[model samples]
Target: MAEWVHDLGGSRGFGPVEVEPGEPPFHADWERRVFGMTATVMAQGRANGSEFRHAIERMDPGWYLASPYYEHWLTGLATLLVEKGVVDREELEAHGAPSFPISRAAARADVPPGAQADPFAVGQRVRVRSFEPRGHTRCPGYVRGHRGTVVRRDGDHTVPDVEAHSEERPAEPTYSVAFDATELWGSEAEPGATVHVDLWHRYLEAVE
Candidate 1:
């Protein structure tokens, strides 16, 4: 049995686990378009579904606190259709594709690489350099310009920021870098404030 854990929003713990293979991959631009549309609807107080709204209302604070903005967008989309009556539980199970569809041309451009990035060795000193911030940045608002050792590096995957925008552009590779909690949050943080953020290769540099 394959059990999946998801954070719906709010303070309650993760809800009943679902058994599944996993979600299919999507182009970065498509994700962005979905997010932008969802935000627009939300701003208008007309989000798509009721179950989605309820899930959003119940999402765990911890997941909500740590997730990227676009992640919230993806989550919202999943919840909305169910609540709105656009899709049913049985329909969801039977449907081959997700509610939002992407063009075939776009799909071809977003395939994952045959090879993946390797994990970082423990205790390696690394630095997070500043770049012209745009679209979406996984580096927390508090961690820019901060120096920290590379606690770990979970590497080479499709960059979510770009995939979130697949409707407009192409998906690219992103690296997941883990930083020591102390480096990002300072000594006042709890014993485990370590944060692992997915960063594009373009966002990093080596420090002397």
Candidate 2:
């Protein structure tokens, strides 16, 4: 499976994650403003959470890798605001703000309740599907094709893979699956180590 720039989990060459002690959430005023704007857009029903994330995934690989985290948020917000016809490119550049007091009365009207049955059970072994999707997916590339034990059933939720592109948010069961480190990272991984991931039902299949 060809990995997108955003799916860098378990990839090599990048340096170790450096943690800043006592780090603040926002580094600048613009980042805080961007976050608030994004929240407002979602509240207005102009966009959904999955749609917002897909917009970031659709960014140019070069710019995506080179930019900071909040910049990605800004880019996603801007893209959705334009695509949803809430604002045009000209108006966005000229005023850099959307009209105030947006409404959420009919938010997520297209999404119906989840009616799917849960097939897999706790402790059941399952394998992540290996197919490549051209659009947004919550499934991480590293877990694809690997077998894992379903540790917990997380109930039904909207499938991000579909919600990103379409207005309808069909529901599906999700599970917390536990995989041994060696299964994903080979023998070099630490002994007795395991990684847990929350995956949608469609991403897994019965291990036969």
Candidate 3:
């Protein structure tokens, strides 16, 4: 079965990808315009990166399939600008393009106290929570409900889960966890194989 828009990773029914090495960033002139506009709006702090991605995620799944890569970015940018009151349909239709000044506060983001203390230390065994989240998340689908050993501590930073919905960037200690490929996949995976994922502390709990 295919998971809809929110549930990416470990889902089925994706087409095979053809990698084009040394490909230019923009394939067409319209792509360049879209990319530049998105970049400018983001650089000006109309919305944060989390909100930008959440905008894309908010798109109808059917719309998502029809959109090309840069089109998604353009959609995200337009959504944020309109939703945040930075721009409106009238201005866009009349002016053709829009730009706004970024606030100083938006430039240097503030950290929220989302983390009290680190849960699992280095070399500790932890299992990822299996439940699906209703909101935006950074956890990869394949790693959920699986156990891994913490190999490194990435310190504390903004949690994307909350950041997507609000202005706050809640802090959480991130970790580099190593999972045996067999655990995440199955015995079908090659023997002695492993995968490393950088996960937030909230996604994991002590295994023992």
Best TM-score goes to which candidate? 2
Best by lDDT: 2
Q: Model 2: per-residue lDDT, tens digit, 1-208?
A: 1466777353556789789999999999999999999988888888898888777777777777788999899877877777778787777666754542221221321222233545689999999878677766777888889999999998989888778777666877899999999998898889999999998888888898
Write model 1 residue lDDT over 1-208, tens digit each, in one string.
0011231112235577555577544447767677677767667654423323334433444565576556655555655555556666567556544543211111122222222333334454456554333223333444456555555455455443344323334333345566777876577767776777655544455456
What is the alpha-carbon lDDT for the whole of candidate 3? 0.73
> lDDT scores for all predictions?
0.47, 0.77, 0.73
Off by over 4 Å in 1: 1-123, 131-134, 166-178, 191-194
Ranking by lDDT: 2, 3, 1
Q: Write the per-residue lDDT of candidate 3 for residues 1-208, one digit (tens) a residue.
A: 0144545554556767668899988899999998888889878877777777767766767777777888788777877787788887677656654542111112222322344545678999999877566556678778888999999998888887778777766677899999999998797788999899998887888886
Which residue ranges in model 3 land beyond 4 Å of their true spot? 6-10, 90-117
Candidate 2 structure, TM-score to reference: 0.86
Cα deviation in Å at residue 38, candidate 2?
Answer: 0.5
